[model samples]
Target: MAVQWHYPLMSNYPLESDTNNIAAYLYFFKVLHSRKEKVPDILDINDITTFTFFKSKSITHNHMSKWGLSDGMTAQLRENVPKYVQQINKS
Candidate 1:
């Protein structure tokens, strides 16, 4: 699947960390479903106890937009799963 990161959102957005992740993943599925994108029907979550799923550069951005998270929070999702980090990596 071709996951695009540069979504329409990310401008002065505001959201909590956990909420962002859930909403982002939800959004990811939404987009994929909308476009009829083919993906493995079975989603192998990292751990059943935790709602966290595997992170990927390809799926990150589009997913992040689903939640009302700010760009700052989105930046944090890269290295830190908390959703908000003080600084973003320039890399």
Candidate 2:
């Protein structure tokens, strides 16, 4: 017997405009879970609530470093997640 590992196929440019796709969405969740951070159940969350949650939860340099982000990229994400979440909701 052989065991097969199944994983979602992620896009080459995960943050591209095609993020409206389910695969991109799943990739987001996968990254979140990989962090092992405590996240609320966001399946039913509205944009406002999601924005509020992200606003309340700051992403530290340590967290970003753990995710292998460069200092500049970490800073970008720290500044962008909340703002980008709004744009994402609109799409």
lDDT of 2 by residue, 1-91 (tens): 2212132222222334464433334344443343332122221121222223233455456664665555654454346565556767877
CA lDDT, every prediction?
0.34, 0.39
> Best by lDDT, which number?
2
Per-model TM-score, in order, reads: 0.26, 0.34
Find the 10 residues in a row with the least total lDDT in model 1.
41-50
In model 2, what is the error at residue 15, expressed in angstroms?
Answer: 8.1
lDDT of 2 at 74: 44
